[model samples]
Target: MNLFSEIRSLVLDALAAMQAEGTLPEGLSFDNVAVEPPRDAAHGDMATNAAMVLAKPAKMKPRDIAEALAAKLAGDDRITGAEVAGPGFLNLRLSATVWQGVLAAVLDQGTAFGKSDMGQNRKVNVEYVSANPTGPLHVGHTRGAVFGDALASLLDYAGYDVTREYYINDGGAQVDVLARSVYLRYLEAHGQEVAFVDGTYPGDYLVPVGQALKDKVGDAYLNQPEDVWLADVREYATEAMMDLIRADLAQLGIKMDKFFSEKSLYGTGLIEAALKSLDDKGLIYEGVLEPPKGKKPEDWEPREQTLFKSTEHGDDVDRPVKKSDGGWTYFAPDIAYHYDKVSRGFDELIDVFGADHGGYVKRMKAAVSALSGGTVPLDIKLTQLVKLWKDGEPFKMSKRAGTFITLRDVVDQVGPDVTRFVMLTRKNDASLDFDFDKVLEQSRENPVFYVQYAHARVMSVLRRAAEAGIAADEATLKSADLSKVNHEAELVVAKKLAEWPRLVETAARTNEPHRVAFYLYELAGDFHALWNRGNELTELRFIQDGDAATSQAKMALAQSVAVVISAGLGILGVNPAQEMR
Candidate 1:
């Protein structure tokens, strides 16, 4: 059970009882009622805004309402004390038994302790890592992959029906470039030397695709015209590139529920259908766009084109659907793609894009809003750039600079778990520095190591307890005399454990996976603080000679920390480390 939510229910019940007894006004709104840990531990265990929210509505003084509510709450067996503080705020100190119950609850639930039903089983489609299928994924795409995957797992824990999707950008001119690049490799596979020209991809990863093509077709299109080879080679190259992408994602432990192909929109009437839907809504119109405001290009001219009236929804201006040349603009198929998603009846859509695409967020949201009539909400998460560091120096990579680092470059140096966790150590909108040396460092300063060590410490305690002939299993430890856990340091951990369910719900509601990472860090810090404090005071230690019950009680507390750490790491898609080495 969620202790916070459980206590919140008690507060609500007391409020309802007040209304029944005419102590409070009838039909007063209590929508803002919340039970959460106070900002300072000295204040109390939990605080609520019930008095302040009901003040104006009940036509009573907030302090007066708070005083009445305090008396009502103090009567509950779980709340040891409830008092009105400054400005009518009510702080309730829960009995130690309630915090003790959290440990028992964690042992009972194991990794499932903090799982929530906040999502209501609604279908949510999280589409991320929509990188161009030209080569192996680079560092930028790796961050997006980790963010989206962790978010999907977090949503699943919060009870949403989450579908992890990847939109492949294979229909664009980029794939044509990929085809020519592979054709050059195809020529090389026939034992002919080829130089990667200015327009072709030069990554060594494509060399294998070239060799594979030669093995399959035996240079059938060697020295032939583009017409003779372009079609077959484009299909072959995209498949090969996707295979490489799949392997790269596998390295990071990301598995997509579906890979939506952009090429499939061509000649399928999907673009036409999507545009027609907008046309019927009067959102599509023919217009001449103004020359961009600040800087007009040398070729700038007013031209009539098919435009989506996105401003009607939320965008700053209407956007082009078909270019002046009468060809569908790049955004035309994208609108159709999202329209297809909306029609498929997903409750929500989330797009994880690179931070450089920040300009595109408004229009995308506008399209989904127009298509779904605001019934389906769309959240676009822009992941900022990852700056790689090595040997205390900034590492720069760009294909143009001939220094671009691929996803494999990062994964090969550091294992997938370290790579994934380090990628999420910062918020998606914040620039992240991924250092080969820092992420792999075995110290408390590294968040990955710190959290892992907390888990490992608990396991060590379990082993020690086992060797001492004490059963450290959940049944025995949970049944031990938990009254021995009276120290403030030990109870601080229980307080952190009490916030798990609430943390899961909040993080999932905001589509934030980094919050889980931050929570684990805080929880790990609390456990470590308590563990170190035990060094200064022997009674705080987990193992006590000639005292099986107290030892079992402290071991139970240690196991509870591991349970939460495992659950949190599970959401992050990181395996819990049984040992640091």
Candidate 2:
């Protein structure tokens, strides 16, 4: 049970009683009323602004409304004290039994303690790491991949029907470049020296693709020009690059539900259909765009082009759909892709992009809004850049990737668990500095280590309790007499556990998975604090001398902490460590 929600219901009931008795107005709205933990624990256990929100509408003084509401709240069995604080704020102190109930709920529910139904099984499409199939994924794509994967998992945990998707960028000029590069490698595999000039890929990772090409079509395209083999080579090279990309994502345990090809939008009338929908809505026209604001390009000139009225939706300017030469602009395909997503009957869509794509956010959101006719909402999350440091210096690029560190390189040095957890230590919009030495160090400063250490400590307690022949399993712990867990130090942990359900709903509502990582760290801190107190107070120890009943009560609390930690880590795609080693 969510204690906060339960208490909020109590407050609402009291307000309803006030209205029925004519002490308050009949039609006042209570939608804005909130019950949450007090900012300062010394103030009370919980605080509410119900009186403050209702006073103006009731034509009454704030303090008068607060005092009346406080009296009604104090009559509840769970509320030990309710005091009217500064400016109609109500601070409530709950009995120890209230916090004790939190522990019981956690034990009874196990890892399902904080699961929420906020999503209501709404279908959400999360598209991320749509990196071009030109090479192995780099550090930037790695961040997007981890963020999107964890977010999908979090949505699923909160009861959303989530579809993980990737958009393959193979229909653009880049794939042609990849084909020519692979063709050069094919020549090199035939014992011919080929120089990779300005526009060709020079990475050694493509050597295998070239060798495979030669083995399949030996001497067929040798000494031939670009026309006869360009089409076949382009298709072959894209599939090979996608194979490499799949392997890279597999290393990090990311599996996509769908890989939508950009090529499919071409020759399939999808792009035309998307633009025609806009035209039917009076959103498409032929026009000349104003010159860009700052630092206009050297070849900048305005020409009449087919444009979409993106500004009518939300974008800063109307965006071009087709260039003057009758070729579709880059924005056209993007609009078509989002149109296709909306047509799939999704309730919501989210795109995880790199920070460099910040300028595209507004136009993309506008496209989705216009295409969906305001029915489907779209959220675009941009993951900032990650700087890698090692031995107190910036890490150099990988030789295999030629220009950047490959995702495999990072995952190889540190395991996938470390990489995933550390990547989420910061929000998606903030830049992160990843220090190899610091992350691997077993210290409290490292969040991954600190959280795992807390879980291990609880595991250690469970093992010792099992050795002592106490029934410490979940079934026994759920029914344990928790009256012995009335100490102030012990109650602090119970209070933190009580916040899990509220946190799950908040994080899911905001589309922020990093909040889960942050909450886990705070919960671990509280658990460790209780464990440290046992060092000084012998009675506070989890295991008491010849007190099996009391020892089981404390073990129940310890097990609850583990259950919540495992649940939180599971949402983040992290494995809770049973032991630090």
Identify the candidate with maximal TM-score. 2
30-60, model 1: which lDDT tens digit per residue? 7899888888889999999999988998999
Predicted candidate 2 versus true structure: per-residue lDDT over 249-303, tens digit per residue: 9998999999999999999999999999999999999999888888466757879
Estimate candidate 1's alpha-carbon lDDT, on a 0 to 1 scale: 0.91
Candidate no. 1 TM-score: 0.97
Model 1, backbone clash pairs (residues 3+ apart or across chains), number: 0
Error of 2 at 373 (Å): 1.1
Q: Report RMSD (Å) for each prediction in the order shown.
A: 1.7, 1.3
The residue-level lDDT of candidate 1 at 254 comes to 92
Q: After superposition, how far is residue 14 of candidate 2 from its true place, in Å?
A: 0.8
Residue pairs of candidate 2 with colliding backbone atoms: none
